[model samples]
Each structure stands twice: as structure tokens, then as C-alpha cells.
Target: MSNLSATSTAQNSSTPIVLTIAGSDSGGGAGIQADIKAISATGGYACSVITVITAQNTLGVSAIFPIPLEHIEKQLDAVFSDLNVVAVKVGMLADCDIIKLVAAKIRQYRPAFLVVDPVMIATSGDLLLKAYSISTLKSELLPLADLITPNLPEAAELISSDVPTNKEGMEKMIGKLRKLKFNALLLKGGHLIDDENSNDLLILPNHVEQLNAIRINTLNTHGTGCTLSSAIASYLAQGNDLLRAVQLGKDYISQAIAHADELDVGQGHGPVNHFFVGHANVR
Candidate 1:
């Protein structure tokens, strides 16, 4: 595993810097846009290194253009060289090369916390990561993550198993997931549509935790994964422990989803209100 330990840095600034290395959503709902909103909303300074650019909106992803590998490296260098980045949230890496490049940079910089959101498919059912890149992601990138947030489909893809439809099915996959080389796993159970409550499993090396919240019924669920992971990264950057950060992130996302109806964005799945509580700190 790449060095999971954070490199020492001066603690002079009050606002913690959080960097997000992900794709860009032109719709301004998910990807880099959502990460920035979530980080700032949760009281962290946000920075980004966009890996891919998508012509996307609430409806769906129309087209994708991966940034050149050289430019991607330049973006990583620009952020890590200047900012005192405390945590990183990775999402929507387009291919094997991008994934490998990102893993190399993380090894070199060794940020304090690494949150990997294995974004294989968008909420609209559009494929994000290439089918062949799954193996590269699991082998080269995931093992380096401090925490990997994978939903049902993503988890199934990582393990080459069937997607779980219920709590029992989710539990059965625990042993399979434990075999993977990663520090911690947050198995998001939001895909269980039949359940009235949303429950997520946090699988640590020594312990397993189940986080539960009442399901908020809404069609405006676009960018939920991106928002939650970025919120967790922001909390981690602000010095919260892993468990605390996950809990806080869950709360923020639930609220955002609950209040999602307030925004009337696109024709299909709309975005959650990142600033749902007005200008007040989301924490």
C-alpha cells in the first residue's frame, strides 16, 4: 500500500484546504462543482483538479472528454505544490491511465486523508469509468485510499458479484469485501429502494459499523454520492475522525435530499440544495 500517513505541514491557517480530483459537470450539479459547494458549505477551502469534462445536466451525461494525461499531471502539481491540502476526494477517473497517474501522485504527496468514491456510473445510468479500468482502479488506486465509498453497483463491480437487493444480501458480501486491499469501506445502501431507511455499512479492519437514516423520498437525487463523499472529505480536512466525518456527511446529505424539492433545476433528476440551511455553517 502507498504511504497512508499524511506528510507533516505547518498548521497556521484556520480554514483547512480540501482538494477534489474529479471530473467536471457542466450542469453545475455534480463532480467538481458539487465538491466545491460541499467543501465550502462544510467549512473547508475547496480546490480541484478536473480529470474529465462532461456535457452533463440533471437529465444525463451526453458526452465525455478526458483531460490529457500531461495536463492532468500539471493540475495535480499545481494544487499540491501550492496549497496545504489536508484531504482529497477522488471521483470519476475516466480510464486506466488517469487512475494510475492519480495513484502515483497520491503516493508522492501523501495527503492526510484520501476518500475514494468509486464512481463507475452516474445516477442517470451513464457509464463514467471505463469497463476495463475497473481492475486498474482496484489494483492501483483503491488500496491507497483511507476510505472508499462504493454504492451497491460500485461494490458489486469491484468484487465481481451481484448487486445486493436487501440487507441480507449486503451482509453476505462483507466477507468478500474484506478480502480487498483497503483500509476502510463505506458500503452505501441507498440503492435498496424497498427499505424505508437508508443504511450504510462502514467496514473497518477490526470492526463494522452500520449508519442508518430515514429515507427521504425525492426525484431530485442527482449528485448525492459526490455531495456525501465531498462532505466527508471536508470534515476530515477540518480534523474530524473517520467515523465522525462519515456521520456528519450522512447528516448533511440527508438534509440536502430532504430539502431537494426546493430547487427546480432540470427536467429529470435535480440537485440537492447544498446551501439548504442558508448561509449558516452546515456543521
Candidate 2:
């Protein structure tokens, strides 16, 4: 573990500092790149620690290279020691070692809020996480997260169950999800293709709130999860309550998806317009 100490000067800054620990997407659509965009767009100063470097685009991920453990520790130390990171959004830990390392650092630095996006499979059907790392993510990292945003398939993978197909099936898995040791779980339902609306469930210890948004028909839905989680972290860093932050994040993502077709980035599965000017009040 790195022995770097945090500076006290960060507290004096006006802008909220949000840190993202994730992989770097060469596509500039997801992972660290998308996270930075979301945080910056949502009124936060963004910093990042890249976990993996992937040869990826809107089409698919062709290759991945996990950062070395020592280098990861250095990156963690470098950011934590300087920035007053009020919130952290974590994504794409490629293996068990990386998961444990991040968990340890989080315990040490103790950011005010932690948002974990359990990234597994890419939109292009490529596997980002190694099969053996799933257990480590469940046991080591997820528990430390203030919020875990897992899409339908990722949720099923966490609970070791089959993916749910409909609203009823989604509701049925709440019990199973509750068994996990997390502060809150946001079960994203965008994967429910047959439904006309994209709905998500925010499950806390005492309550479950349904977040609804009309599904926008578009192929440019890439990086939706990463964008959403980062936006929520930004809002939380800005001192919004949990529910309010989630609502704001939902709105931001909805508008981004609705305006996704405006951009001409990739041939397949283009990215949402992170800089879409319509939602200027989202901050």
C-alpha cells in the first residue's frame, strides 16, 4: 500500500472534486472518458485513475490491458493525496487483485461517497471482467460502495441467478438482491428490451423507489451505465441527498439518450451526447 498523505488545501476550493477509478476507453465513449465528461458536465471537478486500457470503440472491445498493481497504487496515492475527492465512482476492475487493492485504498482514504458500477460485459458482448474476479467484486468491493449500479445482467451475475425478462421477474429478484452487503442497489432495467419504458429500482434497506424514463429508441446508447453512475456521484458531491441525486442523474441520462442521435461518432452503438446543450439546468 502507498503511504501518501492527503493535503488539507483541497477543502478550500469552491468546486467539488470527484474521482473516477476505471478503465480507459480509447473510444472516448465509456469508462474513464465518459465518467470525466459526466462529472464535469454535472458541476464537479473530475480526476481519474485508470485501471485498464482497452482497445475499444463503439463497435466492440478488441483487447484489454490491466494496469500493474504498483502503478495502480501510485495512481490512487497521487489523486487522494492532492484532491479533496468528495465522491468516488469505481468501474472495471479486471481481476481479483485489482478489486482488493481498490477496496483497501477506499478504506484508507474514506471518500465521503462511493459509487460502484459493477461493469462486466460490454454493450458489444465483450467480457471486461475476468470470470474469477466476480467473487472478489461481490465480497471485497461492493460492500464498501455507498451505491452499486448494476444492470439486469450484472445483478443476475451478482446473485448467481438467471436474468429476469420482465417487470414481475425484476421485482421477484429484490429479495435475492437484498441479501448482498451493500448500502444501496440501483437495478437498471434498460436491458428489458420489450418494455416501452426504461425503469430502474433503487433498493435501500427500508425502501425501494422506482425511477422511470420513457425508453428512447436509439443505437447510441453506449456508456449509459458509466454516465449515469458518474452523474449521480457528481450530484452527491454537490451535497444533494441520495434520492435527489439519483433523480437528477436519471434525468441527465434520459436527456442524453434522447439527444444521442444528434452526434455522429461511430457506425454502431454510438455514444450519447454528453455535451448535449438541452439539459443546461441539470447541474
Model 2, residue 2: C-alpha shift (Å) = 23
Which tens-of-lDDT digit does each residue in 1-283 have in candidate 2?
1111222323445888999999999999999999999998888899999999999999999999999999999999999998888889999989999999999999999888889999998988898999899999999998888899999989998999999999999999999999999988899999999999999999999999999999999999899999999999888877777788899999999998999999999888999898899574464
Candidate 2: worst-modelled 10 consecutive residues by lDDT: 1-10
Q: Residue by residue across 135-236, what tens digits does model 1's lDDT show?
A: 999999999998999999999989999999999999898999999999999999999999999999999999899999999999999999999999988877
List ranges where model 2 is wrong by over 4 Å.
1-13, 281-283
What TM-score fits each model? 0.96, 0.95
> Each candidate's lDDT (Cα)?
0.90, 0.90
User: Model 2: how far is 132 from its true place, Å?
Assistant: 1.1
**lDDT accuracy of residue 148 in candidate 1:** 95
Off by over 4 Å in 1: 1-12, 278-283
Error of 2 at 239 (Å): 0.1
Residue 205 CA error for candidate 1 (Å)? 0.7
